[model samples]
Target: MTQSLAKRVEQIAPFQVMAVMARAKQLQAQGEDVIHLEVGEPDFVAPKAVNDAGQAAIANAQTGYTAATGLPELRQAISDFYQTRYQVDVAPERIIVTPGASGALILLSSLMADVGSEVLMPDPCYPCNRNFLTQVGAQARMLDCSANPDFAIDLDTLAQQWQAHTTGLWLASPANPTGSVLSKEYVAKAWQIVQQQGGHLLVDEIYQGLVFEGEDFTALSVSEDIFVVNSFSKYFAMTGWRLGWIVVPEWAVEGATKLAQNLFISAPSIAQYAALKAFDQDVLAECEARRQTLASRRATLIAGIERLGLPVAASPQGAFYIYVDVSSLTDDAMQWSLDLLEQEFVALTPGADFGQRDAHKYVRFAYTCDDARIEEALQRIERFIAA
Candidate 1:
């Protein structure tokens, strides 16, 4: 008998971030001093309080599976987080804790879309969004986002792109790779369009607390039909904890709960327990300090890249990434990135992995490294560009 993969599995594309990270690791193993700026993890350690809570949970034998919906305390804490930070009201019952923000996306796609349904998102979005849609047998459509508009979603363009088959929209505020934050006004307008078309809006807020420029916007503030997804990974420096939660509308709660029960069983018990303490005053302050660090790194890196003659397609107002136009240097970004790794020992992501709109002429640099490491990378990149 011949073994075969399912059609959906066969159709799914590999995550480009992992591929770049793997290649960087392979080169480093060969005695190369690679400066990795390809991955999206924070360079700092998780806060002490969060660590202490995890240790305590382990000591107290809290390693068992939690409720599929999550522990009451963690849910309540997440509810309070939204209320306090965003001034939005969210009941604890509306929150569903999952393995990570990625898990939430999977559950959401399953609950909201089906075979032949379409999910619309901006180009140069996080690759996993499209992959998750394909895994669930949904069509992923890309909306063209221009560099002149800072890679933000334009309402007129979206209206034109919306189809009768479209069932949902996935938007990222403080978007990954671009770091563009969607304004509350823009989100409201977009929500209006979605509602008029009988669709749902899924807003990824994983980078919520990392905004450095204007005030952060929450989707729930715009409309109740919006699904707000957030994680402890980015802002809290809890990448390995793999704990996140979603705020669903009252109508979607029952379906999301049932799906969560069947698919995830529950989020990690110890991690959820640890995350409950993440809302304490001291812990919140520590997280803010980390955000300040990222802000500093953003400023430093943007200046450095601009000085190197690369045009920043968008100045990231939130997330710790700087997406630059590299067409003048080379149109083959994948090759440019590989050459950078080999010759300059600097690892970055090629733009083609993000979208089909001349992404090959661009590259994304993560400034999640420390000040000294960032400086060294800038110096190396400058020398490479000069040569």
Candidate 2:
């Protein structure tokens, strides 16, 4: 007899792009040329200092698990990073290192939300957020958000959605898929509303250093009551290393640490040691140079898409993706993406992976590859559209 799976497992929706990526990989193995813009990870290698540190840790036999809250020095470094980078002061004790931003989200959702409670988010958000809420038996409430005014959640929308069962709000800066960075004033105002309602606000700033066009600010600059999660993945080019940390309000520190101990024990020990060098001047300078490259690629894709007469729903200020309006081309972006991959050998993520609000009319293009490849993708897309 087959074992029955948990009901919650069934409620989770698949990340649609993984299937597209798998098919693209299969085609690549068969000697077909495929351009991959479906994934959201960077194509850069880890900083030299970071990789060296990892090797040194291994040479020194430092593979043991760390403290549940992480190394004290690492936590202090993260706290100091907030001070120097964002000009905000955060106590080291309030920081808890996790396996990744995903781990931090799981910890927050588990602690902050309970069965029958609701977590408010904006539509066309990072889809895993909803799945995270679902895993905790909480509802993911998506409010209709527009790309105009930069995909922000206004005070009025928050007020209208406020309900007896609403537990908190989950947000992102330099948000995934859309790459819209919410402004400091806007985030402060939203924090005030959440405070008035006696609820928590969690902000994911994983793409903090990747900002290009506007001022970059962390939620800590607004108020310390809000929860902030960041990772070494995006800015440090350490995705495979799987290390991230969370900034919790002082009251939640004990509980968060206890949960970390039980759920993850600690983040990767080698990765933790390696990330200590992430703040080195040389490493940071290299990362900044890569940021410029990403900005140029963003410009290339946006201009090319516009030249092809395809509408862009919003302009991405940070991160590496452009959420495009493909309604003129096809009502079903999923099918269109599949057909594009099969016919054009170009892998683009359909907006269906993000959310359900007119998702079929939009697709997310990640300029994770080099500028030359991004230009080539534009040329191929133009030919595909014309054909």
Candidate 3:
């Protein structure tokens, strides 16, 4: 009884999206119609070939721990994919298949972040990234980018925010909430800046293939000096598979492998094999088709939000989210989110989950569901606002 939880455990913030999802689920259980736009995972199932590969792996009983780094074959596939898709040649040795993007992040934060470490990330980023760094006693210094066009960080902004304790910078292409993409020029310059300053740069490319507008650039194309965290969860629709990968600089591969060994013995065995199929031509084509579908979904959702008068800060360039400025409707997004769910059975995420900079003035609507559900959610929002 005298023993207590670690004091740092208190520092971990709860994911508000999950709580909103819970209420939505409760409404569903009670036979009420709840149109979901809060959760980030795609509604599509894994491509048939990918699913078949998983089934085959299970049938073959190929379920055992792989190299702490990853299955050699899957790593090579990812490498080949970079060459084919982005003209970037990343050696297979540098790729680390992980349990999920979160696992890759855990490995990164554990090895790179320390008690006095500071990770500079854009405001309204994927919140879990901050949590991962926090777990390692690293401070997440969120720079307010909500006001920037496309929420993109300029060289000056990043330079000004670079602090003495800043050991790493985390960025997302097709960033969360805002769904904005950073340019190739920005990545190259940022890479140069971080290295010159003796810090590391981490790019979350989980939303890589889901880009709709602007250049579908990969940080890997810039240089191998960057750490890139990617997932099958987004483009491949493999959220439940719990699979992702990280590309570390060649020099850091051994250290990363050691941490991966301690943190996660290996990625899910079946997932590793299944993800191999995700790199197939047919699978890649299917993912591209899905990207087009999401582009359409984005336009539909953006149009509907405009009609409601809660305009998006900027139309998102990628990812399936719109960070709507809710200041016009309500200053407190959390309460507004809860009320919308309870009143009109429309579920969405409040901006408070992302960061403190004007967080109360925004809400994120994910278009991961189908057009029908998205349209329904819009109708519900219209009804809620009208009433």
Candidate 4:
């Protein structure tokens, strides 16, 4: 009955994690104590202040649509956040509040991609990045960056991969799965190389605040020309709120705004008001506390994986995930993930969901849960491996 669906929709791959998540749900319904480690969502909720602000917005009837770009006050709040936190002065007009980082990426792809044009990105990147580019009929050329220990993009490698129809390169700092972050020096140089090639550079820094290991710098600091995608989902614990923002260069703000006006009209008014409180000092302190908890969980998971002799694909510097090479144990990570859930009651994400770089050999474990859950998941892994 749905054979008439568009070819692009058919080309979109199913998110294998959701399948695993569904199975985990079924197990839970059956009264099984399934420990979930597959999902990337933080277990923390938004700060109490943020919650109160959202409720207050609804009570005050502050639910009208904002400008296509965003509420000027929220944009200015983000600007102030940047200036105070990063020492980077981003003008309010350049900031575009989005429905979520997903929306932000769509706006970017719509503006930048065209048929026959390609965008370069690292393999094992956020899977949705490829899908977003695909929806626009643009080529999502995922380069194999698994060989890079830190998971940072190589400027020289990027230069070699630039094609005649290449429109830009998309990258992430403190990226998903491996949680690898790029240094400020690397980003500055990468920007130079891409600029020289006459192509744009899009940076996904959705996991900005959780960076515990390396230098934390925004692509915005590198230059105003960089298009940055950020979200409240990870660090701010606002996934369900569906809020995010994009920092576009001054020259492209109008184009971005027009797309936003048509595609989304505006981000949720209530969420926008709530996110304004996310920059509050007390709220930020709570987010920091959550980050520290995640850091502890990360240590526990990494040590357990090491003890099990599983090879880490990359040293995770931030974010909640750790990419592991499981080829020694199984050739199909998806099947292995399913089996682990069914037998050990521990769920994880397979690499196939992320990319084609030895996709069957890798899986990602997210330590976004509590330390106790992390410990329990590791024990299950140990037992499962021993058996």
> Which candidate tops lDDT?
4
Q: Write the per-residue lDDT of candidate 2 for residues 19-108, one digit (tens) a residue.
A: 899899999999999999988886899999999999999999889999999988999999998999888999999999999999999998
lDDT of 4 by residue, 20-128 (tens): 9999999999999988888889678888899899999999999999888888999999999999999999999999999999999999999998887999988878999
> Candidate 1 regions off by >4 Å?
17-19
Error of 1 at 327 (Å): 0.6
What TM-score would each prediction reach against the true structure?
A: 0.97, 0.98, 0.97, 0.98
When sorted by lDDT, best at the front, the candidate numbers are 4, 2, 3, 1
Candidate 2 weakest ten by summed lDDT: 146-155
Q: What is residue 21's positional error in candidate 2, in angstroms?
A: 0.9
Please give the RMSD to the true structure for each candidate, in Å: 1.2, 1.1, 1.2, 1.2
* lDDT of every model, 2 decimals: 0.87, 0.89, 0.88, 0.90
Off by over 4 Å in 4: 1-3
Q: After superposing candidate 2, which stretches have Cα over 4 Å from the reference?
A: 146-148
Clashing pairs in 3: none
Per residue, candidate 1 scores C-alpha lDDT tens digits across 329-387 of 88788888888777888999888778877788788988878888899999998888888
Residue 294 lDDT in candidate 4:
85
lDDT against true structure, model 2: 0.89
